[model samples]
Target: MKRLASVVALAVVVLFGTMAARALRIATPAATTGTAIAIPAIDTAAAALHLAAAVRFPTVSLASGGPIDTAAFLGLHQYLQAAFPRVHAALTREVVAGLSLVYTWKGSDSTLAPVVLMGHVDVVPIPEPNLRDWEHAPFSGDTAGGYVWGRGAIDDKSTVIAVLEAVEGLLRAGHTPKRTIYLTFGHDEEVGGRYGARVSSTSSWREGSSRHSSSTKGGSWGHA
Candidate 1:
């Protein structure tokens, strides 16, 4: 009887596995035009070019609140608007410090607390030996060698680009997450929030946030 019961259990497990494989095979791209109208993302080649152009916009912040690279910051902002036209056209974009950009995606339930994902756009001043230490120009967003090289290439800008890309891709695929995703890009986090005196300011941040899932990090992004 025991042997017979074990065989029955194994057979049931195999049946479930077969059903799962069949289900996966059945999942196909739905025939629809909903995604096609919402998002037309920039091509991968153009995306790489946008990253390169973004990295070239020198946005190193200062502590004394003196003159800043306003032109550079503004240019990057404009680049974002141009790069993710789907996002710019659909999501409401709010700019702070001429660089800090916040994009909010309303969720199915607006009553639930919003999830904020934080990143910084500004990079630290290039060290004196920065150019010598770098294989490519520090400010140059070189897309050569399968890499986007720059001071902030792998850092916050990547996060910014990623979130925008995800939204663009989702809107294109007509998919939406259950909860809201808030993107906060700080402009002066590299300078201890003292960039540009008191005229413009960067807010203080922590490694984690309580606004989102306890298991999931708020995604405090920092990379070389």
Candidate 2:
């Protein structure tokens, strides 16, 4: 009985191994066309500076649902306006729920549905005990050792800055989109998106845009 069981187990393992090998052989990657499009160069130094500056704002959101730091968010808004003047001039911007922002870049084709891109500006508060353990000040926006160190540097702030930079660059190049684009920046995402994302979404819906594709705070992409 032992010998028969061993033989059966060996046969099962061999069968699975053969199946896996066959699957691997048939799972070859598709060939690429090898066509390369020329992308415009971006000013990395300036972008880094902008990101660092944005990180300086202590727009901390608490789980306790405390009062917001209005000054910080307002300061960030002013800085963005100064940094991307072209974007401000080309797109129509609206403040939602007193803190969140929505910018609409109307396209040439009215028939095409709009696209939405989202990010959050708020970050979780750093505990006082853990503050001493940080290599750099959480709100200092330190650019040292080839890295931007701060609270909102990686989360949603980077996404906001990146999208704005791309749009600003495109606007400078005089490139217009065929489909309308919406840029939504939520303020209270860390606590909950109630006053920020939810309101902005409703605003977008009111505009009659049915097709929605978005990239949210933690690099989550979805279609609605």
Candidate closest to the true structure, highest lDDT: 2
The digit string of per-residue lDDT tens for model 1 on 82-150 reads 877877776667775555776766667655555666666787788785569888888978887888999
Local error of candidate 1 at 36, Å? 20
Residues 69-167, candidate 2: write the lDDT tens digits: 889999999999999999999999989988888899997887877888888898999989999999999999999998999999998799999999999
**Candidate 2 Cα outliers beyond 4 Å, as residue runs:** 1-38, 201-206
> Candidate 1: global Cα-lDDT?
0.67
Residue 201, candidate 1: alpha-carbon lDDT: 35
**How many clashing residue pairs are found in candidate 2?**
0
Backbone clash numbers for all candidates listed: 2, 0
List where candidate 1 sits over 4 angstroms from the true fold: 1-46, 194-210, 213-224
